[model samples]
Target: MPNLGKLIVHERMRRGIGPEPFADACGISRQTLYRIETGECEPSLPSLRKIARVLHVSPGKLLDLGA
Candidate 1:
């Protein structure tokens, strides 16, 4: 299975987005974003949906990476 953190990082970079703005867009603190991206924490479902919306992806795309 793919690491959720790495997938998040790859997709974020692929879209040319930086962490701060991305976190802001997701309504999360940069520290929370860092934790999620580093596998230190898993995002709450609502947070995951927010992240997917920001990234222009479906939540399943993110979830499937770890499935």
Candidate 2:
């Protein structure tokens, strides 16, 4: 499986976006984002879509990174 959290972190950081504002932009709590990023939880499809939208990448692109 793709390390979704790491992908998210990588993309966010690549864009020079910070955690707090990124979570805010995604409409999720920072704690929830943290959990997802830490692999403590998997994000739902909706959350994945939100994350992808923010990252300016397709959700499939993120998933494909692991393939």
| lDDT for each residue of candidate 2 in 1-67, tens digit (9 for 90 to 100) | 4478888889999999999999999999999999998889888899889999999999987776532
lDDT of 1: 0.88
Q: Which stretches of candidate 2 lie above 4 Å from their native place?
A: 65-67
What's the distance in Å from true for residue 48, model 1? 0.1
TM-score of 1: 0.90
* 46: Cα error in model 1, Å: 0.4
Residue ranges of candidate 1 with Cα displaced over 4 Å: 65-67
Q: List the pairs of residues colliding in candidate 2.
A: none
Clash counts per candidate, in order, are 0, 0
Q: For residues 7-54, what per-residue lDDT tens digits would candidate 1 score against the true structure?
A: 788889999999999999999999999999999999999999999999
Worst 10 residues of 2 by lDDT: 58-67
Q: What is the TM-score of each candidate against the true structure?
A: 0.90, 0.90
